[model samples]
Target: MSLVRSAGLQKFRQSVEALGGDPEVYARRAGLPVDALDSDELLVEDSALAAVLEIAAADLGCPDLGLRVGRAQDFGMLGPLAVAIQHSPSVADALACTSRYMFVHARDLSVALVEDPDGSHGVVGLRYSFSAGKRPLPQATDMTMLFLHRAVEFLVGGRYGLRSVDLPHQPAAPRSRYEDAFGARVRFGRDAALLRVPSSLLSRPLDGVDETLRRLALAFLSQQSSEARPLVTAKVRTVLDQSLGTGSTELVDVARALAVHPRTLQRQLAAEGESFASVLDSVRRARARTYLTTTDMPLSQVSDLIGFAEQGVLSRCAQRWWGRTPSALRQEARSRARPRA
Candidate 1:
């Protein structure tokens, strides 16, 4: 059984109760020591805890209900840190700094920046990677995602939402919760999960900085560190290659398949100065180039082969990556391929 301090446990129970679930029943089914459940400290098996939460959510007909609880508790911890970073001189620096600070308590997760040639900046994305014996519960990961989504909203004052959200599972459930929380296009059955945001939105200056609050947040982050890497470019490349034929990849599934906590995986990638989304973009660009020059496959088929949601998204990405449309690129390649006549 995994034992956590009572304070944290109580908060979790309260969240469950708020969702109209019976805390005592959940505690019992999750194998919490009866006395421990009532005490200030709690001991419960991780798998059991995960199962209880999942069953509760399913019963409520809201696979994302746990997410709501997580957001309320965790976003409060993250908001000030996000604000501090947002108030930094530029989005680039803000993101870099945020990544450093955000990982202290949440060492399993990571944040990174993605810059297109046109000066558009994306959050790159966030994800978790677990180490061996530390698989994160889906409820836990979902909750973390909720906190992240809400924190971003808090930072931007709700001006925008995520551009896209990717999940590693088949997406049989949690569709509505994802939609409600992210309000963006959701893709499941992908190798690595992602949350994409428009580059333009990153430029908005924050309201102001609170040095005292910022220091507290940074201090909190400073207290923790773990030596795991989830967003490694190599890992991302491998996953993309594997998904080329499947046409769908889920980030959570990849984390599970890799036998690491999703957040840990993300932190490792952040430490490496890369993100899953950035790596995916790189892979897509590389593949596009190769297919344009070496294969006679039509653009649409090529786009699908590379796991793009649509040819239009592929076209836009190609233009951004190479400063030319797919056809233009193909024509250019063909021209170069022709021998002297």
Candidate 2:
């Protein structure tokens, strides 16, 4: 009964259509929500996705369909999780973040760094698996493994020293296809989906690491993780933060971002003793405080950044929230930051 984010199916429709099959037909036959295909906002049953993938592979006679789909997808499919991983200091840290928060993508999927199967020194194993019951999911497994390899490739900006790939199920595609996908030797009928890498590569640093963006992205993912069991308010606040400057902070827009109906979003917020306007104002106030204190940006620019239409509006809000003008607040912040003489 575990759910997977539909982003996992990023190229599903086009991939199916390219193979001359109706994507909707495959989805419906497998009990999948047809509308959720290739979407990021909705969750689908993991088993249903596995079923559709197997069905498509069988009908299209394309055993490597999963690999194709996986190959086409990039880190952007991961949304904020990608941002967090990309900014990680090292490849190992990125993998660790993925392993810890992958439930934000799929509840029953596991990605871990493990010991090499052959007890080989100076080698490490990266394993990927789905807990989708006894039913064989060669296609989904292939796709996910290829995805993991590609993700690491993106992180390290190249091949990542892959030595071999091992899968639990027999090759759905030709052995060469799997090997080609990973650019390494492919072994079938093994214990799990594992990629062997030189242990040294584990410590390789990622380029363009940004501590601030990484912290923000990790905070967002942590809030979205199942362990957080986040309330509707948190979700709404997150959507607001992303959409604030875009002039789309309406209830409908936030609800759409969350894949929920407006009324449903409102009702959930009300159940928690909140409302959309109140949340929006709270977000604005917090953002205002951060901008006024941290940077010397002009009031007009700060107004736009926080979703207000004019500087006058920001001035009024500053008065309401802190009983002072935005300029006065910024001056006070500057004074506090100054060294005492």
Candidate 3:
């Protein structure tokens, strides 16, 4: 069972009720015991909870219901801080303030406003670095992006959408749902999940402002750090790094590198919601893209650098991983690098 502790629980319940579902029934479907739903403990873990949310959304005829719930929850938890941002002089300041306060309850996530050097625009991106035994699932990342997109839209009262949405896993279902939810080009199987929004949106005015609320929110966030890293993730990353550039990468190699038996490493990684295959694939895919785009090196040479035995094998894997051919990827990279008219 996975644990869940959302600061927006009350708001989530209200949203569910508004959407025409009994909160108790929703909680029960989510696998939470009856008392667990009403208790003030603020933490519960039952796979059924996520399932319940999905089912509730489907029943309510809101394909974006999950997104709506997430936004309400985020707003309930961060509204005061958001109001303070609304009073700020510029979008940049608002984003910086929001980013600071948003982490109060969820320090596992990071948000940044990255400005383009040419002064064209900026991007607001989110990064999640999970603690040991707590890597987020792909659905969780998608839900978070959906919430952020909706919250920004609510703040601006405009049809705001991401410039790009990046994910670490390939799409498991039809692509239309992703397209409908994000309204942006989605890139999957990448190192980290990211949702890129225009920098200008950061400067837009918010609907409320309250200094006291901001202060309170900041205080609350300061007290929460359950998302901090554990030594395990660092070790896993290290093992992955060393195993790359060699065709001998395997579970055994990872176990030996971490000074544990293979089974122990497997169990530990499983606890963290990852497997050796997933980590290795991430490392190779990231390195492959870096080599392909950053250098004029031939595809075969790039394959060698990333530990592929043959260019053909690398090409096949890259296509499956990125949904694009090598030549097409290179062309797209060049186009992105070109100067705008």
Candidate 4:
């Protein structure tokens, strides 16, 4: 439902190859073409990128794949967004660049800075949100957190300053794995995903601020943004993910929540070469695969969570999504997660 730059997929390829594994084999298992490496210009479907990273992590037996990939990346890979941020005068300006122009690089995901109202200290942090809910990027959250720290440090080098971090999901490994990787205290099951730092550091200047490129990047970004269509499909997917199991995944309800007429929303989707039912089905399939492969919940519960009428309807949908039964997918997930003796 959203377009993702193939940078994540590219980095995964590099990581897999470093492990002496064939990246194409892993990618094909996740329904992506080996030719994904052919063009850095190519964009991938958001759910496909998630599936690829999730499966690749399992195949290579690297539970910390996202963190590893994020560690290796620099800002140059971030496309136009990187260009805009690299010349910013301060960390705050860089974050503002991300908040405004991140959509140019990645869809469905948003990044922003927020000051901590509760903290006595000068606490501010970056927060991440998924346009299609938490289900969209199950494996990418850690990567994004690491990227945030690295991108800022690429400007003002220091302790990679972070006060604390929180994630919405449970940990896949031991607490030490996270704390060691992040160099910060980490907590899970948080209401949101955030990485907090001192508000005073926000004004720290970059190493080499370029006045000329900054103005040029701003001009290009402004032009691209004006012509850019609002991510109506992304919003629709988000609403549908939240609405499922609550009441209806109906178009009218989603449109109303977005504060637009249903037909107007349909027109926007049409411009983007999407439809309401297609977006709903995309979110449902992504959630189904994620829940099936990650959690041990029964198929009946999965059905209810994704708003399927019953297990039978879910069975048909699962078969279409993964070419296997829900049980088979779960079994495969568990098998891949098992440690080799």
Q: Residue 44 CA error for candidate 3 (Å)?
A: 3.7
141-161 in candidate 2: lDDT tens per residue? 888888888888888888778
lDDT of each: 0.59, 0.82, 0.60, 0.75
Mind sharing the TM-score for model 2? 0.68
Candidate 1 residue lDDT tens string, 44-94: 344554566666676657666556665555443444455566556544456
Rank ordering of all candidates by lDDT, starting from the highest: 2, 4, 3, 1
- Cα RMSDs of all predictions? 24.9, 16.3, 20.2, 11.5
Please tell me which model should have the higher TM-score, number 3 or number 4. 4
Candidate 4 lDDT? 0.75
lDDT digits (tens) for residues 164-209 of candidate 4: 8888878865778788878899888877788888888878887788
lDDT of model 4 at residue 156?
79
Q: Indicate the residue-level lDDT of 13 in model 3.
A: 65
Which prediction has the highest TM-score against the true structure? Answer: 2
Give the winner by lDDT. 2
Off by over 4 Å in 1: 1-15, 31-52, 58-61, 78-94, 113-123, 132-137, 172-174, 223-341
lDDT of 3 by residue, 201-244 (tens): 65566556565765675665455444632234446755666667
RMSD score of candidate 2 (Å) = 16.3
